[model samples]
Target: MITLTLQTIGGLMIAYAALRVHHRVYTEKSIDKKVVNEMRAEQIVGIAGALLLILGYLAAF
Candidate 1:
């Protein structure tokens, strides 16, 4: 049960990170310092989410 919850949350976070970049960053006309920073933060979130997903998968066994 805990593993399922973790996997779900992790998947959502990963999807949100990807969608945020596609919708917010992609629409920008130019790349600025702030946007770059936001992208970096999002990347971290995505990586964390990926880790959670892996952890959950391992826990299932």
Candidate 2:
């Protein structure tokens, strides 16, 4: 039960991070400090989310 919840939350976070990164890469005109920080943040989120998802899958089995 908890595993399922974790998987769902992780999936959502991954999706959000991917979207943010995509937007930052395509829409931004310049690589400013703020943009770089945001991209790094998004990458961290994506990595954490992926780890959560992998853990959830392992817990399921």
Candidate 3:
């Protein structure tokens, strides 16, 4: 039961993060001042999402 809950939370977090990234990339005319570059943002978000997924998978065991 705990594993299922964790997995669901992790999945939701990943989906929400992805949606936020998509919205930012599409709606914003330019990258934020803090961000070094567009590619960097993509890489960071991608890695974070992948890590979340891996953690969720591991939690199932």
Best by lDDT: 2
lDDT digits (tens) for residues 1-61 of candidate 1: 7768776776877677686775577456478777767777776777677777767676777
Task: Judging by TM-score, tell me the better candidate of 1 and 3.
Answer: 1
Clashing pairs counted in every model: 0, 0, 0
What's the lDDT for residue 41 in model 3? Answer: 68
For each candidate in the order shown, give its overall lDDT on alpha carbons: 0.71, 0.72, 0.67
Preferred candidate (lDDT higher): 1 or 2: 2
Off by over 4 Å in 1: 1-30
Query: Ranking under lDDT, best-scoring first?
Result: 2, 1, 3
For model 2 the local lDDT of residue 10 reads 66
Ranking by TM-score: 1, 2, 3
Q: Could you estimate the TM-score for every candidate? A: 0.54, 0.54, 0.45
